[model samples]
Target: MAQAPDHAPDHSGEALVIQKVQPFGEGQIVLTTPSLDADGRLEDRHSAYHENRSPPLVWTPVEHVAAYAIVVEDPDAPREHPFVHWLIWNIPGEATSLPEGLPNEASLGLIGGATQGVNGAGKIGWFGPRPPPGHGLHRYHFQIFALAERLTFGPNVPLETLVSALKGDTLAEGLLVATYEAPESQ
Candidate 1:
């Protein structure tokens, strides 16, 4: 049996501190909005059916991090492996939040020196959750990594490249989860 590529070995052993995700208010890593409801149904406006806006994200900063990376994936996708929805890197260490609805572009000018990579759909930046219709509820995992060194890679690198580079260099990490289910009708 093949080991999961997304499951990095937990070597850091509780040394890394992951703070609560801010969008859900307090004491929560799993978040929800009317657009991304608690019932695991995403609003059409936040899906491919409509506007497809990226949800806002915020977290407490870690100490001594030189840069940060975010990876969003759906482990429940009916495939050989999890599906990547977003890959963002080179976020300035001082940064702590991503505003809602970032443009589908490579460079996010408003966010300090941040850049986006290709998503599972092969599009740049965020590709909001749009699981196959009636595929049931899929959990979207939003993982943030604090790196000891700033990444020197250019834009649009594959997620594997980023993950490979992160080995042994992760200073801290955080996680947030949201769920979405495609409407049965379509």
Candidate 2:
């Protein structure tokens, strides 16, 4: 079997280090899904072949943060920039964990006034890995930003706008990486 490489890059300067607390502990964020293996390869179940649900995530927030945001992207996608898979913001600073199977809706009532934004595919909510066949492995980065203030944007905001709004306002951030490749025959 081909082993998945450690595709997670070093975010030394500006990126904040996330402290994972569940599923796995105190390292890269653990994406708990029977659909993926220890090395972050996505199984058929978590891909387009089956139910494409968001993976459960848990982490510790930095002190004094007023709000949090999450952005999941595929940096290896064949595009000019990384392909966004999920974008959510306005997570209450008090929240330390996100439950599995988050609903594919605009407003997440259960997550402390959190809202979903459009992904790279121009859709809302979590879009699971669906890399083209024979494209080798793709790294999916799940990044969380700790902001010093609550954002004013509404749901379905564009990725660029959200990113721009975060500038100079981020207190800290964390990252978790996962990898996936499409079946050769698919």
Candidate 3:
């Protein structure tokens, strides 16, 4: 996962989680988000320090794929590994984008039966960035992994389990990179 693309260079820090996971099979889906500013900085509302909302994401749609998973992590956090901000999976392969403001629930029945896993905060669904105050900036890697089949597990999956399950099973991946920083005065 640490295989840097030609797109983004500065990843805050080389997150341990990113350093572990292997790159997907082959090919890549173009991941894009409108929630970020032109400079690729995450918006205030999409932050845990503010509105704490999940950002909307769009990607290049594919055919014959089983499903897709979205994993968002902050590599710059002072942690053992990258801090996971969101863990959502089972998105229908036919889908090309996710709508904004997804509710913080385990099973997302609204969006093609997608289920959310526990985030780094131990909360279900998307946990917006809350990098430490005066921590400078943290790059959040919004990675979408294309699976060859649906995961065998049920709702509320754990991070480690997901990582283990996806080991070399990713058919492809799409990434959207954005950065966030807590206000120094906050």
Candidate 4:
């Protein structure tokens, strides 16, 4: 029952990812997934209104990384900034693939006691895409941060806090962008 910092985090994923999220020099991990369709569209099974499950994800291993963090965001939401679908952290450095349908809870034992952060929905773990119906297509940016050291932070850490902790510890970062379009209204 730990609380995050006293302030709120910037909800703009673009701002966070591009400007604020700084990893070591020109470093990028090749993030990939087999869950998306040929057109790089996410499956309905991962939709918030549907199965609401997490898609399987895999990334190329980075050298000398002690941990990894991932943040899934939709910069196309009707709101002013990006909408966070998943806020997860504390992945073991040896993990190269995340199994599909990870339970929505803090502290995952399957991944060596990895912890989860809060999503835009104010919940722990992954909250699959639920863009408004007929809102065109939304781009989900699944960003990953490779940390040089294992971090230990207070509970309920916001995305900002995690990003802050990654400042100098980030060895590299990468992304796998996926698209989703809600079905039009009946």
TM-scores for every candidate against the unseen true structure: 0.77, 0.77, 0.86, 0.88
How many pairs in model 4 have backbone atoms within 3 A of each other, for residues 3 or more apart or on separate chains, i.e. clashes?
A: 0
Candidate 2: list runs displaced more than 4 Å.
Answer: 1-36
The alpha-carbon deviation from the true structure for residue 59 of candidate 2, after best TM-score superposition, in angstroms, is 0.8
Per-residue lDDT tens digits for candidate 2, residues 32-62, read 3344587877665556545777877777656
Model 1 regions more than 4 Å off: 1-36, 39-44
Give residue 92's error in model 1 in angstroms.
1.1
lDDT scores in order: 0.70, 0.70, 0.81, 0.82
Cα lDDT for residue 24, candidate 1: 19
lDDT of 1 by residue, 1-186 (tens): 987668543221221112222221122222224345666555566566567888777777777777778888777776655777888888888987777888888887788768888988989888888887766777777788777787877666766677767764677666777777786777
Ranking by lDDT: 4, 3, 2, 1
On the 0 to 100 scale, the lDDT of residue 69 in model 2 is 84
Better of 3 and 4 by lDDT: 4
Q: Please write out the lDDT profile of model 3 over residues 85-180, one tens digit for every residue.
A: 998888988899999999999888898889888888988888999988876878898988888788867656667788877765677777788998
Clashes of 3: 0
For candidate 3, the TM-score is 0.86
Residue lDDT tens for model 4, 110-132: 98778887888988889999877
Tally clashes: model 1. 0
Question: RMSD in angstroms, candidate 4?
Answer: 6.4
- Reference-based lDDT, residue 14, model 2: 26
lDDT of 1 at 117: 86
How many steric overlaps are in each model, in order? 0, 0, 0, 0
